[model samples]
Target chain A: MYEAYWRGMGDRCSLVISGSEVMSYLGGNPGGACWFLEPELEKSIRRIHHLVGNAAAQAEDGGHVVVGTGSTQLLQAALYALCPPDQPEPTSVVCAAPYYSCYKEIAELLQSKLYKWEGDAHNFNKDGPFIEIVTSPNNPDGLIREPVVNRPNGKLIYDLAYYWPHHTPITHKADYDIMLFTFSKCTGHAGSRIGWAIVKDKEVAAKMTKFMEVTTIGVSRESQLRAAKLLGIICDDCQAFSTNTKSQNFFDDSKRLLTERWDKLHEVVKRSETFSLAKFPKDYCLFSDRFYETHPAFAWLISNNKVKDCASLLRGHKILTRSGNRFGADATYVRVSMLGREEEFNLFLERLSTIKIGICNGIAHIN
Target chain B: MYEAYWRGMGDRCSLVISGSEVMSYLGGNPGGACWFLEPELEKSIRRIHHLVGNAAAQAEDGGHVVVGTGSTQLLQAALYALCPPDQPEPTSVVCAAPYYSCYKEIAELLQSKLYKWEGDAHNFNKDGPFIEIVTSPNNPDGLIREPVVNRPNGKLIYDLAYYWPHHTPITHKADYDIMLFTFSKCTGHAGSRIGWAIVKDKEVAAKMTKFMEVTTIGVSRESQLRAAKLLGIICDDCQAFSTNTKSQNFFDDSKRLLTERWDKLHEVVKRSETFSLAKFPKDYCLFSDRFYETHPAFAWLISNNKVKDCASLLRGHKILTRSGNRFGADATYVRVSMLGREEEFNLFLERLSTIKIGICNGIAHIN
Candidate 1:
């Protein structure tokens, strides 16, 4: 987990050297009375100011709220600060089924009872007396669910992790009570470990900030500065280019690769009558409709071993993919991220064909 | 605050750019679901493994803990995990007076009642019935108290922020339940916003970890990796470089610089003869002695002149310093951080001497 943070932040080479210097200074030299002088800290903070815009702007605009440490740390702070230790326990958290696995883990960790609302690929009603987590363009399946924005009963916490690729360019319009975004998914910088929250209420923001103060002291000043710098460049590029060029390119690449693989997978499933597949939503940014159509049977096949589950299939072919079970889906439904290069996608498709044919022949021979 | 973290890690220009690139990819990109991909996460985690040391070793030895965003986060987590929510009230925290200002803030923030034990610099005792905070070479005054290896009646939470610089070498031998360390103070990497606590008790560590899991999800994976890398380098250097050369050189520079400033300040006080000075413990690190001797009159001068405090001195001389009152010390005692190159230091000394004489004369004239 720690390493991922460094990588995500783009600290590849110097981390060891810097760590060594710190250990040496602390453990060996022991300079009197002035070891607390943090020269680098001042510099890093100054640099981040440029990236995130004026710190004052963040306070005033209710945006650019860079988090401390991991987004999880902030999440915990939000729960603690908003829920109040003294108040009656929160009724429950309403989470979309097949949501990010950690949402449940975090809720459970906070001792908040979770209420899962299963929904189709299109939309999920946000109604209940609980905190609602609307993860747009859901994970594993990559289907975007337009929020039921008018639901007034529960507080809304939007995890727009995959929303960038699937939804229209409406990030500016997302005026939620609290919205979470991370650096890992969007930019392929999984190691930077930076995240932010766009929060509306001042009281809630203050509580969250205080909670952050108690929890992490603040996010890594270094990470924030770096994130701010990168974000600045991105924003500039986005503004200067005719369209949201970077995002469009990303979407195009993702779609082309995903569609190519999905078609191949569909052909294989059709050929192998014994094996089944899960269908995908028509407007989905990932997986195809053909897979979703046969989802029930596919689920049974995976459970009964008529065909190998996603993890096994991928592992067997030295290909790595996420198991559907982690996302509240059947074991048979595996999410094959199309973020890979073209050759890698081709290889995956080839492997899927071979694996399905082999599984069918093996079953027939046994019969 | 955010920028300081990166600077603390000692990241150079090129690495900063690359780090920014990674940040953009992970954070600013569209779809933002990249964090969910385990492969990317694994790559980051693997790097951190090398930086922090064998994860296996950390698990086995249980001492090699990675830091989160800031020590405060870990502290909050500890409180949350250890303190029962069902309890009627928050836990009571006992702290030594003139301790780190944040200790009190954290306790209060947690809704815990704080019990402060004021201590005389010359003669102090360490017996309490609360979670005692023993800051070795304490803040504000730089006094290193004896260790409490066995707390028969209460719990001990030690803040070793200044522990590294005061002694000949940093020693992790002050057997306590939880020991806090920060890179900002120790490594001059305040901006990194990374801090960790070494908890001897497994239960405490587990609870803290669980709390952390929910809060920030984990510290920025990127920052941790960078920290681990930096620490690893320092460790390697400590092994390779003999203490005689590197250690001596390091301390000699700091001692020479600090002693010269201290002597100069003492000479100024002696010449002025307007206020009496207090004596400090031989092992004390902060400039508390200087303040104790000279501050009563300084306070009178400030009050009479309607100058708010020492921080206002910046307006007069373009010199920045912290107000001592912030550290639970006399309001008149302003903390002048010794930061500057030699020439700058000389200029500061000259300005300080002039200010001292001018202030004394003005007081006398007014009287």
Candidate 2:
């Protein structure tokens, strides 16, 4: 769908793998600290934690790090860690409405009796062990979330996929008990498939590692090696990424691109009078100490009473969007991705503006 | 444990990853054929299948190929595909008495209601739905195995991890319903952690893919890319990895190394009067169309009645081996890895010779 946009970017985010890497496994070597993970990757992860002042890293109680294929794997590992095999009934996994859609599917797919998907955490009335997944800068809507229901046995999983400085402002050192972060959004290396979790408890981390061992025997050591190198580069460039006019850093380019797309969409929605968007405040970044513009991975757009299924409404105009129902939201809402390259984002804006022009001309096109 | 031995072999298996791969997450690009897999990888897998007439690949009954993180993950996936959630009870999964040790533990770890580890496929008489795991070129004891249970409703899972030409004689095309292979044994890239399954059933392949998607999402695309390139290189070099008369091809090198070590151990056991090795017969290879010597991934060694545990018996003489009890065999037997580099094999030979001298001197150290 974004092929033209990607072509226009033209090596802006292009990658080239060397022949040597193509020729060798270069992972899971006897020299590494463990059979599955590279020691350097672990060190780089530690370095990045300190550099970002991640809450878990800065907490009085230190956290253990476990790398995974991606945050999704880590999420499954977390669920595995939380639920023991001997439980009489499957533990409930609850997420708020407008939650990331994969939560329910991942839980139910295994048909694992250890845990079962029980919908919106707020309505979970059962008195038992349950897991609550909160994605800060949540996908689809891009809202910061907190645990709504407090239970003695409830375990909170903080998915910080979009909490990076480029995607959102670094408000404070985030020190959560179970937090997840991925290299994809932070450095735009989604193809690498590497993510890490910071856990406050030791046993949970060990169980998570055991799950990885019997699954894939752990993450790709080559991927981890590459991740380590790239992470070092990301850390080295972060401070000067958005500053220094001479620097062309990933964070700077990504933030500038997403902010422009978000603003353009906001203008188009306002002009259309047929759609609206939830307001995102310009918050002060604790690290940068400046008011940072809102640049979400996706824009959560709502129909202005004219359309029922806003996703289908957008589809009629040749623009595809994810329906709100996927996120357990009402039919009036839709999510349009803003992470596309300039050409695609601009095309979406153009189509959106044409809708506005049609509305002004008394052409009510909803059928 | 074998650090000194590994160092003695120098750069025989050293791997070097390059700088370009470090900069990018280079797989499943938008231009790639699919989001989860690279097109070249799928092609390479097919190419290797034809190059080595693996039974599942050559059979008149066409099969589908699914790449996995590793063969272990594929094993679990097969179990997941076989046991439906609606089943009244967990299906029983059984392997032979001296099966791969991991089969039982990995099955029981999840404590999945879908399947339970039931020992020995032959003894499983009350089974409603059962999976029979048959490991060809079985680990711990290097021998080709066949399914013992011929029940109508039984599903067979063939683990062909050591069926490659280097490890065993490719006597005929194997057309099993399901066969598993890995790059680790074929190309000596164990660290790559990539494996493929050839399945005769479409529904089974789809279920395996679903398991991957919900687990690690899929195999590491970067690893897949690397495996494809490496396999291509291996295939290209098969006719002439070593051009000179003094040098050897991978098959020649690996077979010669294992055979020499096997003969040395055979000589040592005869002299020691304290242990014995199962006789492995020489076989004819269909691929090479020549009589090939027996060369296995491991040597199954059995201590005399005087010893209670052969693993600990080896450990006493500064050698460590896996206990046969792990593979559901008696403690008197043990598994010695023969796949290590030449230096390690030489060290093992030296230690085995010493056991003979110890017996001759009436120093029966084993209890």
Candidate 3:
């Protein structure tokens, strides 16, 4: 999705790492809570968040930046940090309905005695203590969400991966205790596998660092240095430009790209009687200084009553999509990624627009 | 330790990554057993192992290469893959006494229900199912080791990190079910945090890959590419030279450096009344086709009874060494690193040579 923009930047975004640079596990961030986080990367993370106003000021909020392999590692680290090891039973981990599916898988992968995935937050009632993952501009359905089960004992891990201005409106600075952000979603460098958590509490931050240490012995220093350089480029561009200028600023250009994609997707969905999409209200984006509807990374496509399994239906048509059932929803819906290459996305739109649902012996069949 | 060697190589070993080269991950290794394990890296890994004659031939043995964040994560993955999740009790995980302390911590860190750390394989009795870690040319003691607990149900994870020719002789091609290696110890690229496990079973490899996916998504693409490049250089050097060549081949230069350090260390230990070093018998290395004494990355320094806490004694002398007790050994033994920079190693040797044990009011003290 973001490869073109980066490719266009060319040598300016290129990273040249010397043979001897960052050959030790310990990075240059001597004062950082996370020992392995590079100081330059930390600075870039804080600056980006400050510029976007999606997260509270790092210094004022006492936030410590902890880098991980990706938000995937950070999520697990957060679970490890928040949940006490000596707990009598595994603490119930719940997320709202239609949440990111991997939450359940990641939480339960180790069969960790510290925590257990108990499914949807709406169904979570018998919790002495729990963890609610709030993925605003949620994975399958792109709706701005708040904690469904807000309780004093319920710790929250706010996955702000899709909270960027291009994806959705940055309504206000989030002052959450724990927030996870990834370079993958932020800049489409998923291959880099760089993610970080902005944590408020010192002890939690230390514990997260310990988790990183014990797990992978800390992230790759090469990745850290590269992320720092790339992020620095983005921040530098934003600083140089005051208003929305095509190709001048990263966020502006990305927003323009996403908006165009969303418009095309809306047109396809409108013309096709077989599918429907959620209608988002126009919200004022503080970062962009304008009103815009949410242009999520994924489109939650709802099939008409004739189709029972939307994902299988699309699969038959040679279009790949994740079934909504994976996100604890009915299989009638499928989550189509809006963040593929332009040509791929266009082909998917073309395929989706031409699909016809016909009744064959009282059973709906794709023609 | 190896920084100087890499630094001297200059641009020949340097890596230049363009912005869009490996952005989406799903690396160039589409046919690899591990989805994200880059093709170039897998080839290099197999080639190195083949060149060194450490692990069995990858193709002939049906071995699948699983890249990890480091051997740290790979160890956990091996444990995850070997242990059955549905087992009534956590599978006993044991290593020999004076094992790497991290094995105990990492195994029990998550309080995982699948496996539990049962210290010292020698002490491991009444085990129905168990996983034994055999760190040949072992961490603290630098002696070639095999699985202590030999049983039908006992699975083995061979940590051959120090099994390289420089550290120890490759007496035979290791044909273990699961063999672990690291770039850190192999090429002295510890900061890269890249490690790989060569497994005979496809199921085990798939499970390990799944563990990587759920945990940190996968290893960094940049690090993989860098390791591939570094390994390629090392292989190319070896292929170009038939015999030992100074500064021309990686292993030859490294072994030369380690030999010199060990010689100096042996002299210091021989002269000092407070300390004694292990005497390893000369063994024929197939790669070099010569008999050479072990010159490990670490020195297992055994102190005289008068200096009970050798690590503390060294700390007082301004030398940092891991406490022997940390490796489940007595306080009289401290593991001193021979892998530090030349200046630091010299300072340590100078301080170590001058150290004297004194009795102050019947209690032993370092003077």
Backbone clashes in each candidate structure, one number apiece? 79, 3, 0
> What is the clash tally of candidate 3?
0
The full ranking of all candidates by DockQ, starting with the best, is: 3, 2, 1
lDDT of 2 by residue, A1-367 (tens): 2233223334433434433332233343444323355666767777776776555553344777788888888898899999978888898999988887778878887677899999887788898888999888888788777887688888999999888766777777788878998866666556567888888887888888777777777777556766787677656666565566675455556677677777778888888777889887778776555788557788888877646677776787888898888888877788887866567778888887776412334434563
Error of 3 at A93 (Å): 0.9
* Candidate 2 Cα errors over 4 Å, as ranges: A1-35, A58-61, A239-245, A306-320, A351-367, B1-35, B56-61, B239-248, B352-367
Question: Quality of candidate 2's docking, in CAPRI categories?
Answer: acceptable
Better of 2 and 3 by TM-score: 3
Better of 2 and 3 by DockQ: 3
Query: What does candidate 2's lDDT look like per residue over B1-367, in tens digits?
Result: 1223223334543434433332233344333222355556666777766766666563345787777777888898889888887888888899987888889878976667788899877677874888999998888688878889888778999999888776777887788877888877776656567888888887887788778777766677667777777666555555454355553355555566666777788888888777888887778887666786657788888877546677877888878898989988888888888766667777887887777423435445543
Candidate 2 TM-score restricted to chain A: 0.86
Question: Positional deviation of B154 in candidate 3, in angstroms?
Answer: 0.9
TM-score of each: 0.60, 0.87, 0.97
- CA shift of B248, model 2, Å: 5.6
Q: Report the CAPRI category for model 1.
A: incorrect
What are the per-residue Cα lDDT tens digits for candidate 3 across B1-367?
A: 8899889989988899987778886887766679999998999998988988888846878899999999999999999999998999999999998899889889989999999999989988965899999999899889889889898799999999999998887889999889999999998899999999999999999999999998888899999999999999899888877654443878888999999999998998888777888799999998889999888889999876446777887888898998888888888889888988899999989999998786677578767
Ranking by TM-score: 3, 2, 1
Could you say which candidate leads in lDDT? Answer: 3
TM-score of 3: 0.97
